[model samples]
Target chain A: MNRVFTWQQVAPDQWRNKISELIDSGFFYFDFLTGVDRENIDGQADCEVVAHLAKPDLSDSRIIFTQVKSELASIADLAPASSWYERECAEMYGITFTGGDTSPLLRHEGLGRPPLRKSAVLAARVLTPWPGGAEPEIREDGRKVGNVSRRRQRPPGVPENWLSP
Target chain B: MKHSFIALIEDKCTSCMLCVRECPAWCINLDSHTVEVTEEGARRPKKVNVLDSFDIDYSLCMYCGVCIDVCPFDALAWDEHRALTSTNREDMILSIADLRPSGSS
Candidate 1:
């Protein structure tokens, strides 16, 4: 399959103008917009706002991305389809969008941290005991025997100190 | 055709935990213990994993079939039989015995 990949990184201040310029040039079709958490990546933006715009016939497409510390100007006014996407980015990545409806998208109440952020800890994994920690033993008269010499195993993605006493 | 449900073949399962870790929903829970098998005239006793308990919470499962795909032992398979529905939420969790094919033991 022949495919062309085009992407550009723009400053947060020029994000709204870039989308408008792209639409006027020929890419008016709005594909989708979302936020990427770049906390783990070295020397990158805290969060990256990415949007895909394509021509009406789907011949050419461009990925417009902008790096932001925590806030980005809303492009929903220029592209109506991006309103919900902006709201989703607001709730998921904790990105504040100005000049648009940044209402709650998936969350009902205020949570501690953005769920998609790398720093957000998975509380459920820590609170519940992992079943993989079970150790085998011999049974005598329905009673377990022998001491467990193997160390307990932690589930993947869970931190070591989270399970420590 | 009826909706397929996950069936566990007890003897084939070594409880390696591949399915539990691969499950994206985090619905599968398993417990296993190690049994020391000492043979006659053997240098050292070999440790074998014994399957203690395996539970799948259907409430959280998305029926993605990821667990069956990642089972290295071929212990898990899809059965054509319809899955049971329960009124209580807690009853949705199927244990090792409940996951076995019907009419087998």
Candidate 2:
């Protein structure tokens, strides 16, 4: 059976130092770094940063997760392998990393809001025309074949405000 | 001489809406309506959805075959044939009636 590990919180101030210490202690492999948006929760940061580190033999792995209220200190400078992950998280979540490259990885400048942000709503329907042409129904000898009354459900990830139409 | 084409089994299709969701090119347009289905030797009838129309716009289709792969029921099949060609854009939109077997019509 595969075992799951819990995320350990790292203070924003000492995050870099703690990662470095883990690296020095043989946790050399940097697996991934990502962020989650938490909008419903109050008194907590809107984003959470999660990073995974492991040994070369894959015997042991550790996860470090921190609730970032604001800008987070960079560990890419210490790990080197985490540069792209940091860049992606920064681009998608709009979380800045101190002493690291804040350049966008997946998006160009001035495109829009960081898509992964909790408050970021998708593009309105008016901006993007519905690709599927007019819905079709079968008519047999001037009578409908089967009549389904309800409208189709909206696509996932569409905000509630966009459901009016 | 040989030819192949996509064979659509209209009766087997459950109208699960899987092909509509999986079609990346947005070439497929489908609709369904609910109707009563009475099983043989059964006392009561069950309400089920009957597919209204399954249309595919060949003008926009890239022939990626994603829709056929995602179908839960084996309603769509792949058949080899000459390339689809038409003189007008409107002719490229294939309706459910056009998809029926050659002799059945």
Candidate 3:
């Protein structure tokens, strides 16, 4: 069986230090992330971050999880150690890494509702004018593409947009 | 070389030492009514307390999939469902969670 260390839960603000410790332990692999419902009470945002760490050989799999309550929410970005793939995490999940920009990854023209966040409070979290301009030139693997389409044209390099409105 | 691993099923296993007997590494350990893998790194199966440890010496496993094929209760499995990093012998010792859908690399 695996072991679970339930010490004082790490607050969102403390995630920076916590991540540093994990990275130092040669546990660079940022395992998993999800919103864990830790509230058995009337109401509490006791969410948790469940992470699994493995030794370099992927052995010594250690499953250590931490809890975060609503009183102290929003983890800041961990940079340097939390770069590259880390950025992707922030943009996708609202895991505010200490140094990461609290920006939306897919703001969808920066106008419509953010499909990722389900909170009613964020009805208008999307910044106006969105990120891209009207009918911005979309790029595909370096080349510009028209728009999203369903039909597909045969052959190696045919752009799928060729069949769209 | 194909990696070979040893899986333990406590209920049907009874720690009979059959798998351990067959293993040449002497890496399997029976303790706490469970099989513990002392192996440093390799695709180790994820088991509970009934199973102490599952050590797969990646350096030695030949990927024979014998452990999976030989388990009496079909508890042992060779997870080729996902191809992982082919480098580093340590990468072979799959984490305890890696044995599941969420634990995957």
Candidate 4:
């Protein structure tokens, strides 16, 4: 049976070596690489970078994550397959991938804040005052007003009590 | 031609801005303002955005039903025989006051 281990938090400097050792030990496929935002989540670091590696037979796979304070050393050279993924992580999380492509992946102009970061405020979310499922009351004159239930709707993917109301 | 086209029911419209945003040709225009008014028996004034105007430029309309589909309220409809046509291009624009049913506000 293929074995699976819990997510490991490795240091930024050890990222490339550890992944290379795993590749030399039968895991030859580099599946995916991405970043996670955990700024307000309890017992977790602000940012986490993860990579999934698998074997050609697909029987065993390793998922590893590492906490990044601000930036990390890039493993794009070691895992050439993760080049685009690393570029995307750099754009969305504002994390510098040292010695790697710093070009924007999704945001072509690199105009605003990193959208995936918790600190990046969404203008659309702010403009639309009401949450999903709450109907604004319509008046006879065709004007709609916000409901006065005093319950604030949380934005999608945001944890409760993390931001001030 | 002689087929059904778009019609706006002004009274039922809540000025939700759904139709305005969904128009692919950007032919829909709207104007509204929130006003405080006391109802017949209400003790306090209620806030509502009074719809001042809603216009659709049929000259630029591609006849796509995106606006009709996006409206939360059934304020927009398909008028079988009431589609208007004129020689002047300016006559293609229809406003909320012009769309009202006969003899009604």
Give the root-mean-square deviation of each candidate in angstroms: 3.7, 6.6, 22.7, 10.4
Where's the lowest-lDDT run of ten residues in candidate 4 chain A?
Answer: A129-138
Supply the DockQ value of model 2. 0.21
lDDT of all the models against the reference? 0.83, 0.74, 0.43, 0.74
* Sequence-dependent TM-score of model 3: 0.30
- Distance from true location, Cα of B9 in model 4, Å: 28
lDDT of 1 by residue, A24-65 (tens): 999999999999998844565699999999999889999989
> Top model by lDDT, which number?
1
Candidate 3 lDDT by residue in tens digits, A53-152: 4556665544545554432223234323334433444443344444444455544444542233333223222222111111222344545554322232
Q: How well does chain A score by TM in each candidate?
A: 0.80, 0.73, 0.41, 0.73
- Model 3, residue A38: distance off in Å is 6.4
Sort order, DockQ high to low: 1, 2, 4, 3
- Compute the lDDT of residue B56 as modeled in candidate 1: 87
Q: What is the interface RMSD of each candidate, in Å?
A: 2.9, 4.5, 28.8, 7.9
The CA-based lDDT of model 3 is what?
0.43
lDDT of 2 at A84: 91
lDDT of 1 by residue, B32-52 (tens): 666778999999998777788
- Minimal lDDT window, size 10, model 4 chain B: B96-105
Clashing pairs in 2: B4-B79, B4-B80, B5-B79, B5-B80
What's the ranking of the predictions by lDDT, best on top?
1, 4, 2, 3
lDDT of 4 by residue, A1-165 (tens): 747644666777898888898899988799899999878435545788999998888888889888886688888887899889999998888788898887776687647878889888766544443223233444444545544343655555344554455
